[model samples]
Target: MKELSKRTAGFTDSVIRRMTRISNKYGAVNLSQGFPDFDPPKEILSRLAEVTKEDFHQYSITWGAQNFREALAAKQSHFMGRKIDPDSEIVVTCGSTEAMMAAMMSVTNPGDKVIVFSPFYENYGADTILSGAEPIYVPLIPPEFSFDTDALEAAFRQNPKAIILCNPSNPCGKVFTYDELKIIADLAEKYDTFVITDEVYEHIVYEPFKHVYFAGLPNMWERTISCSSLSKTYSVTGWRLGYVIAPPVIIDTVKKVHDFLTVGAAAPLQEAAVTGLNFGDDYYANLQKKYSEKRKLFLDGLDTLDIPHTVPQGAYYILLDISEFGYDSDLEFCEVLARDVGVGAVPGSSFFKEPENRYVRVHFAKKNETLNEALNRLADMRKKIAVKK
Candidate 1:
């Protein structure tokens, strides 16, 4: 071959997914990926069964099925505190992955620069590259995962086309607060930059933290593209149902990008997921309660093991600081963890643009039994994987 696609020459298989394979190869409890080990809501499951016989097996409208969009708009409008016109504002995609890609492609040109927070979900890095946008990485300083004001404005000064915001951020689990969102909104308005948000974990927030929708911020509806999924909220990662909600002008372009990219999200899954979108606030409250318990269970185990970790405010992920283990690479530590310690985690370095290598990310989006088993296996870390002096 003369040359493979030069754009992808540097791309590697996703480390999060790679760790899932390693975990399976070693018969370890897989906490490397964020999918729930438990089942989705029974209502959604029941609806899915009914949809099989209802001819939703074929495609719906390429943008989305009418009923699904109406339900989604109602649900989202309630939470976003604004009216959302389903017909003009939404473009359903194969998943938030495609939703984000469509948004990026719709907003960016080949030489555009987009701001990406370091230690973001790995896909954002690939999304910017695939969209032909250069990424300007600003660090969300560790510990609290807070960004400095000057650093953010400095990135804005680069005249970027857009910025990717991962609310309840992955790998670091930092939920952006209202004041922080205001700062971002002000800068975005000042710089005339757009914001593309990944909000798959919006409902998985913990106590004392909240997920503020960027589109709901002042004067942001026009410049914000909200990309989210039914994956985390409904625990249906395989369903591949996600969407982009934006102003009609932007949604028009994103709809075109989405149509050429994947046409639409799964018809049957979208129909089934409507049960979840219409679920009352009680469901979300219960979800928070369940995840809060899991977070406590896992964090307490880490504490007993004397491991230092970042206490997340939202999302189900935890970043275990492994510096004391004295490993040269987080990747090596993760390998030994899966092989010898019987647990799996993503090497933290994979998610960072900085030279970071002392952390590994794991998730607790599993059943109590699964989380307990992973925690039990993790108790062996000190005995099994210490570095030699």
Candidate 2:
């Protein structure tokens, strides 16, 4: 009968998950939650089947399984352009969700300020609140989703404890350029602030854009806590395998936080995903090619229907403009879109700190046939839902 947790009292169910439920209710093609409809790599799947019969049933190390850490360190070091010590520099988490939460808790105290970009993944907001950190939201301007240097520096001047960086950002899919990242690095160094990154979409970048690892920047290795996951890369969101890559000191705290939080990521799943972590470069190259094709197919279909959208530079998400629909709330529009147009979307408002409602976010991570079906249903959108005057 006592008051429930004040930190989470205002929270509603995740709009992304809510829309997926709505999609199921209406028998719509669910594009709201960003999970692939296709299967994971045959190699990993084959290994997973083999592992169930093996001796990975019990819990592994509290921080991570030994072989999983080694494989992840090797894979990440190759791309991140540095040697990552599997023993001291990593804490495998339940997912990037727990990775971010643990990172937030590790670095921040109650009432400490953490800079977060507007139009962020919804979890960033919740993570800050749950960690007892105050969020300083700086807008990532719409359409291009770029932030101004002056505004970011101004946020830095507030003496925040840390900043949350989402490279190949969700919803908007803006891959932060090296120059942009340099500015952030400079500010972080000048302000003596920590940089906690969500690099979940690190491998999913498109052509002409690249994922620059924040910790790889000069003088940033000690101050950066890089949180990422195997979920997106391996198409195994349900497996919940993610980790924090930071300096030994920071990771020491993260390991403690992680141990108390989830004890460890699923032992068998981590063992299975180690197969994916050890995959050759050819696998990543093929993944890039496959996502590129899907992006083109989906965006081109939207263009053919004259549906206005923001093209993603990295991730599989697209933000569709619905300004002409005249709906006061994008949430209502998304529900109607699911019920009538037979496609699901998350209201853009859920991702933005600002009062925004002119767009809804959909993903192209489904199979080609699934995307085509969604596109076909979307072609009848205007006719299906009358535009209010």
Candidate 3:
């Protein structure tokens, strides 16, 4: 028999999903994957119910349903401070997962290089590999999760075809400040590269920090491939609806790729999500408030246990430093934590380009009681580790 593709053999299972299985095996409170344990908004749910009987079962336009794209374009344009032609510049996808892949395949050729920040969303690495592009990783130094501009510029000097940016980043929750973004934008412009962004957490930011749309910057809209999902914002991850917004040229290419990929997202789901896209500002404000409360509840628990962590500025994750535990392998540490302490987390090494066993990523997208239970279990972790020491 012929051997499998080398690419397929080289990849391993996702750490986040693996931890989820471990959590299930141990009856642990699963915080490994970044999905909300709570329900989506009532309005979204109602809309879905209404669409169930509607005639949206058939495939809509290969790009997107007309009403859905129009609503999304208007909403996104209002926030992004740019005009968007839905027909010319949007391609609804299965999810941001598909959006990323489509964007990568659209712009990149085999053996091309792309810059990925270390400690990035795990999917970016796989996206690069699947696109047949080599990734050049630059570390986002720990605790602050900030990049060194010099290092970034050096990577850009390598003339990567693109850079994947995840603002309000997952697993660390650091929102890229405007100043930080400017440095990257400058580098992208100087290097003549595309910027593919994963902005699923655009509305989940904490107070005092704002989510910046990369395409909104000067000369960036042309070079920026904005990939985002309605999943995180509307808490309808199962719906698997996302889109890419870019200049006509890139969007045209991505639309062709997306059409061949999934032939557009589920029609009913896209139609239902239009309700969410047309929602008022109050809906977003309330979402921020809800996530902020969840963040505080979870972070306060971590503080009380004296676990060192990076306070998240946005998104639903916190990276906890566990170097003092003396374990050189984050996978082992996470397994022990799940089986012994009844909680699950992602090993930090999975997200980094360099060897790192001193951190673990925890998600705070749970109900108050669930988070309290996880915290209660974690309070005893120090005692158990101390005994081992």
Candidate 4:
């Protein structure tokens, strides 16, 4: 028999998903994946129920349902401070996962280089591989999760075709400040490269920090591809609704790629999510408040356990430093954590470009009771591990 494609041969199972499986095997509180354990908004759920009764069952448009795109365009444009032509600039995707892939495939050619920040979303690496692009990783030094501008500029100097930016980043929860975004924008402009962004956590920011849309920067809208999902905002991850906001030229190319990829997102889901798109500002304010409360609850528990971690400013994830455990393998640590500690986390090494293995990421999107239970189990971690270690 012929061998499998070498392009996919090196790909391993997702560490986050693996931890979820381990969590299930041990009955652990699963915080490995980033999905919320709670239900979506009542409005969205009701809209979905209404959609099921309607005749919007067939595929709408290959790009998106007309109303859905218009609603999304208006909402995004209002926040992004830019005029967006729904007809020319939007392609609704199955999820941000598909949007990222579509964006990568649109701009990248085989053997082209793309700059990826270390401790990035794992999907960025897969996007590069699937697009046949080589990734050049620059470390975002921890604690602050800030990158050295010199290092970033140097990476761009290598003539990368694009850079994947995840603002309000996952795993580490770093919200890229305007200053940071400016440095990257300048580098992109100077290097003549595209910027593909994953801004899924745009509304999940904590106090004193604001989520900056990278494309909102001067001269950036033309070169930037904004990929985001309604999953987190509306708590409808299962709906798999996302979209790409880009300039007409890039959106034109991306729409063609998206057409051949999935044809279009699910029509019913898009039709239902249009309700969320037209939601008021109060919806977002309440979302921020709820997530901020969850963040506090989880972090307060972690503090009691004396677990050293980076305090998240935006995203609903925190990266705990476990270097003092005297182990250099985060994967092993995470496996033991799930199997023995009754909690699950993604190995931070999986998100890094370097060979570091001293951190693990946990999601705080679970219910208060769920997080409390996880914390209670974690309190016994040292006692439980002492006997075995």
User: What is the total number of backbone clashes in candidate 1?
Assistant: 0
Residues forming the 10-long window of minimal summed lDDT in candidate 2: 256-265
lDDT of each: 0.93, 0.95, 0.91, 0.91
Q: Sum up the clashes in candidate 4.
A: 0
How far off is residue 374 in model 2, in Å?
A: 0.5
**Candidate 1, superposed: residue stretches over 4 Å from native:** none
Residue 93 Cα positional deviation in candidate 3, in Å, after optimal superposition:
0.3
> Which prediction has the highest lDDT against the true structure?
2
State candidate 2's TM-score: 0.99
| lDDT (Cα) of model 1 | 0.93
lDDT string for model 4 (225-320, tens) is 999999888888888889999989899999999999999999999888888899989999999999999999999999999988889989899888
The local distance difference test score of model 4 is: 0.91
TM-score of 3: 0.98
| Model 1: per-residue Cα lDDT over 309-355, one tens digit each | 99999999999999888888889899999999899999999999999
Error of 4 at 254 (Å): 0.8
Q: After superposition, how far is residue 18 of candidate 1 from its true place, in Å?
A: 0.5
